[model samples]
Target: MVNELYRKQLYFPFSHESRLEMLVEKERKRLLKQRIIMHIDMDYFYAQVEERDNPKLKDRPVIVGADPKKGMGRGVVSTCNYLARERGVKSGMPISRAYRLCPEPECVYLRPRIDYYTRESEILMQIIVEETKAMVERPKFEQVSIDELYIDVSSLRSYKRAKELAKLIKRKIKEKRKLTCSIGIGPNKLIAKIASDYQKPDGLTVVKPNDVDRFLVPLDVDALYGVGPKTKMRLNALGIKTVGDLRRFSLDFLKQNFGKFGEDLYLMAKGIDLREVVEGFEIKSIGKQHTFEYDTRDLVEIRKVLLAEAKAIDKELNDFGLAYRTVTITVRFEDFETHTKSKTFALPQTGWSTLLEVGWDLFKEFYYASKKRIRLVGLRASRLVELSQLKVLKNETRRF
Candidate 1:
């Protein structure tokens, strides 16, 4: 009878698992409250760069992308300033469409200065790293992309200190580069990533541990990272519209449907994320690219750019004591069409000659495919392995 009673109690809607979950969740919130993470995103990065270079374009709508060709260009806009956005222009929109949307006489369209942008990025990254060193114990810096990063500053142990650091970083960038960025602070990467975009250009938003649930529950389920359109459709089919609704489902139900991603969704709905900021030279790949001043079918210019990019990538690999077996090149043509080609070697390569030869071959293959007038060219080295690890593996194989 005792066993039967306990079995019935376990079968009840509010079971021991539910009670234990509440306690576990409370403890999790308490622990997470102590962590401090920051996500910094450059606002209108490319467009802002152009604006800074030419102060005359500051107040006017500026677009940093391909020529619109008077509403006939075929390519996409890489980025635009907020003023252009207010007039219905957007990134990734066709240049022709952007011209049609804005349809104004004063909107300025400019080609992307890839070299100039790269120099600015190097300078800004240096400033950020230098700022972190000024702080206690040099925080973890995770560069997510050319213009986004995550910093773990839990060592500081105070929100006030974190904000001060963030402000200093921003002030330094403004002073040096005349650029603005948006920053978000949270307990983990997910919250920090979302919070950074919660505001617009040059904004800062913070989310405390206790406020995590309140901040996330009312938002759309799609707001959580990794919930794509297809996953969202499936979630909506189950009447899970908001993050709060998603919290009601059991992990088993989510797993039965979404496999591992379902578990992630369940945790995210409750404002739980366990990810760390990876420090320097901790990247899967390194790359360099160039956007031409004008579209051209000339293979000579294309080859030169590829060679330069290869040399740079090779040097970066050597600096990191890393080797890569795969090389990829991306080409955007005058008509705004794009294509990418990749080649993988049996052994990881660290030689400059090898990188250039591989990069040139990849470029030749892509150039011959359509022989289109190239607008932009980029090369990347991927599938990396540390030199030490490669050496260890070779020694082990020799014994065999």
Candidate 2:
């Protein structure tokens, strides 16, 4: 009787392995019906760079970001290896908190060397572009941020063919750069992006067109792009906890709750994304920021921080052959309340003195109101125009 009960629990009344085989066969058939897309993401990019250059650091926990200062430091973690992540350390967490979690004396922490990483990334991208014949989009070389990319392989003949191409890209990148990447193949960019993250640190996942529904059904609503904390809370309250639940709602019902974004959410939950990959992308913004260890209202320290950030931004822009038309300053108060002030100049400026002067003025005029202690300060320059365009502007502005 117990054996019978076990079989009942494990298998349906049909009690045939053929039934299970049929299910698998059905899924295999469904997965073959759509366009193939792929998203590629580098794993622990920065930390891996450190390990690559310094072999001794290999096989040890590595954290790459700003100084930890013995658990009394400010700033956030950029990236940490899987080993460190296992200890509850994560990217974007407070470095101090990471220290508290792992507390290993030998845990390696290193400042980001953007130049080195950019060169390494170029090598990786070259290999990918050559192997897949796919368009490559890159952020500015100097920024060294977001070491992830999307490759549209829909033009490829088959999903199996794309998987073979993905394996080659992975092999070349690993052999040349000594780093690993997780790749996901699907019908659209959204599905590809989601599938890529389903695995990590050297993984490959392929989702054929027919498998999209089953693959997405069990995922949480938060998995949809653009759904933040506030949005997730609202979704949960509305009984939309998973993508399957979201699919049940009519477009009109979703729009009623979320406006146009709701419509977008509904479409995404249904695995409908139509974004195309574009190559030769330019940097949208250039900036530097720092979080303080303690919140302070002292203008003196704040100004110092602003100047340092300005200098860093100036150097970064210089390296990238870019210039900024607007200077933005961000202040985060002790309670996590944040505000930003920006000033757009008629001309681009890369000089440290000019950037600091304008940045200070913008902060004084916009951010000096409250007695709230500031826990973080940041400087950003946006509305970027090329340095060559700045030269043309300078010549045009000169009086005849």
Candidate 3:
């Protein structure tokens, strides 16, 4: 019996039942490996909101940003409707320049109504979250930004399911908020994000894993996220002007030059992003501010106020059961000049004194930079992580 147990079985007789079970397992594995992701971006979100609420702005070019002051505004364009964009106006272009490109009557420049936009965003997100939940349990959703989101719908499967969901989402947004959105579907988030931007306002594009290479190879390397002008120039110098070129570049050469970032870029070129669609988005920073009855230049008084604000943050952070890794000091001068300085730690700290120490260091650095009297000073703690969640992860890690 011992000898028989020690001897390994070289072969087993095949049967119909065994063959069927093996096929079933293979199919299950294939299904389990499937990934379907969608990226949805609201078109000219702020500008669209302006036109949606007021039909009068529909046929006109609407530029949303700072007050153009007829031709001499301080800030830049937040966003512009497609009509404005056609005339060469763009988001982040200086308001003065946008005014130059397309003067008043040619375009209607308006300041950003952030509250209105936020309300609309909230309504849209709530609708999407709830609607997706009805289709899939704990449906993977991530709010990429104020006007962009990514959803994982692999559980639903099929291009048909993705298309139906996209149509439903667009319809829902139009019905609820009278707004339009563009959506893209792909095997992963990278392709989805890129495809979402492929067509203009209110377009849907789908790219499967098999088609990813064909789609990306033709695009410029600059189309890759995080590839700025400098990086593009460097890539151009390396004769890697296109996505395919970057992908086909020598791996060792890239590593010797770019280090870890080279590996990341290589993976990106291969359309392989392993990041999951995370659920909840945490508030990055918590802050407290005060406006004094009078503007005082007293550093002692400023430090005292800073300490008080830090202490308040301590109480709040403690109550919230959170810790922070960044300390930022906000200073606004009587002249309306505002600046903020911050320091980020390698690890999060919860102690009140730690907050005060970092806060003071930041304030002192900025305070001496310009000897102008500080009208108002504030303290903010950011890069927060929940203690309860941290503890849970730690315990789970140990158990594993």
Which residue pairs clash within candidate 1? none
Give the alpha carbon lDDT tens digit for every residue of 218-270 in model 1: 88888899887778999999999999999989776887999988777877887
User: TM-score: which candidate is best?
Assistant: 2
> Given candidate 3, what's the lDDT at residue 29?
39
Per residue, candidate 3 scores C-alpha lDDT tens digits across 1-400 of 1122113222324554344334433433343347889899999999999998889999999999878888866567889999999989988776778999889987898889998788888889998887777776446888967888999898886867888888898999889889899999988788889889888699999887668779999899988878887788988999999999997764456767777667557667767666777866555677887555457788778878888898999898988889888888888876757788888886567878998888888878877788787767889999998977766656676795
lDDT of 2: 0.78
Judge candidate 1 at residue 345 and give its lDDT.
Answer: 82
For residues 10-58, could you state the per-residue lDDT of candidate 2 as single tens digits?
4545535444334434433443454566788898899988888899988
Error of 1 at 19 (Å): 8.2
Off by over 4 Å in 3: 1-33, 283-322, 327-342, 346-382, 387-400
lDDT of each: 0.83, 0.78, 0.79
Ranked by TM-score, top first:
2, 1, 3
Between candidates 1 and 3, name the one with more favorable lDDT. Answer: 1
Task: Give candidate 2 misplaced runs (Cα > 4 Å).
Answer: 1-35, 53-59, 134-146, 252-260, 314-327, 341-366, 387-400
Candidate 3 weakest lDDT stretch, 10 residues: 1-10
